[model samples]
Target: MLKRLLCLILLCAALPAAAWDNRGHRLTGELAHDRLQASDPAAVQAIVAIMARHPDKARFDRNLAGLTGEARTRRLFGLMARWPDDVRDTPADRPDWHYALKIVHGWTALDWYTAGKAEAQWAANLATARNAAAPPAQRAVALCWLLHIGGDMHQPLHRGHRLDGSWLKSDRAGTIAWVRRGPGLPPMELHQLWDKVFDPTGVDGGDENGDVTRLHAAFAPRAAAMVPDGGFVQWRDESEILARDSAYTGPALRATKAPAEAPPMTAAYMTMLRTIAERRVIAAGVRMGAALQGLR
Candidate 1:
């Protein structure tokens, strides 16, 4: 029994990180879009029209091809919800808009401001989401960030950067924060692994929107558990805590040790990480709904 338990632990600890990935973004988008659909159809319509004119509308439409009716509409909203991340190369991209801080163990807004980073762009982007006074096109752009950043900020890595000695070396929020749980697994980014978690396995073949629906269903309970009263700051604080507790600590430290040694993965550890990933995604979706409705 002891040996079997040890083996299970090894398998679990080896699981990858999750964040900044498209599928996770899409789930948050779809979940937020669903909330808006129920509470503010007009906001939904306005967003749909704006997405129609997205700088990369051609690609969005291509993704929409071959769908119809409610499915088309749901998929459209899901796509719109995630559209901002897809336009990184276009002029529409706002690099700072995606993250608020390179957080430390006990970071404050002052620390972020001192580092010359905005407290949170999503807060300001809300103006565009709320501004009926602004042109529809402009508001649509801000709305994308509002939706996109809600999910982005929930990513533990996004709220904080890993420190190396006295200097910050977060590897671009873990784009380069590599890890190796054991010998058999390939080296992977801490951020990339988190982003890859919660992906829908055995999804309805190629019908990605169906996968979106399925994902929302899977995460709905996690979203319910969030019950947030504040906004980005609340979420950011939670993510920052998770970063310290899970992302930067644990097997990660030993995984990259000088002796090239580390602890093994365990099922218990894997469950804890999954819980964090699912909860963050769901919380982002729920808060996004409130943010969208509040704008309207």
Candidate 2:
């Protein structure tokens, strides 16, 4: 019995990590785009150079592996909610570039509630790291990952609630839930609405051509409009409210009568989801650029 229990404990421990693997690909793609648009040209150049250095897909995967959970999640979400300060003072010692990368990566994952505190800490750490300075190559890699993660954190679904139907549990009101059931099923509450049911239909699928890019272009403007113009506290409050109201509607919660599972796929829903995702991706890029610029 003890051995069986230990095995069960180990299996439970591995679940989060396993879940992370499924989502990490999209997250990494988002961060890479964010880093390329950093306000600091030197920083952008530095990041790109680093990415060029290790063309190995495995290294990129490994870097992403370190960016899951609450702390990092909070930081990434915060970047979207507000801008960074430009005040600068060189520090005496530089921390590990990898460490700094992780810090920034995590910071980008922040949401509205944790944004204020996390932003402050990120500023301090960034200053210290800047003072310790890396060659253009390493800095570039760090910056890119930071930007990518920041974008990932902002997708309404990414900053979901914990208890009332968020990613961790299967209440089906966030990205995790939507992803589990591709399309065509009854929507999983607000998340499905946001992810796949909010928009008009007929825009769902495309040939393998440049459909993704075209989709990104379509929603960029709306997303840019959604970027909040306020302080971290304000953003956090807004995020909290959004999570409570939209993602966890009372009517939706009461409707659940069985164990959770993915919904069926439908062309109409897929089209709606694509539109929503396009808007989110564009907004993420614009907001990340604004945050890096330290603009209000």
Candidate 2, residues 1-296, lDDT tens digits: the string is: 43233223322321110011112223323333443343444544433344444323344444335565432332232221211111112241111211101101112232222211233443443343243255444433334434433433343443443332122223322323332234444444334345333223322333311332344345434543554355433433343454444434433333332326444434554454445445445544554555444211
List ranges where model 1 is wrong by over 4 Å: 1-18, 103-118, 166-171, 181-183, 200-211, 221-228, 255-266, 294-296
Candidate 1 residue-wise lDDT, 133-152, digit = tens: 87766777777777777888
Each prediction's TM-score against the native?
Answer: 0.78, 0.45
Q: lDDT scores for all predictions?
A: 0.62, 0.34
Candidate 2 lDDT (Cα, 0 to 1): 0.34
Which regions of candidate 2 are displaced past 4 Å? 1-43, 54-132, 135-141, 162-209, 221-228, 231-236, 254-280, 294-296
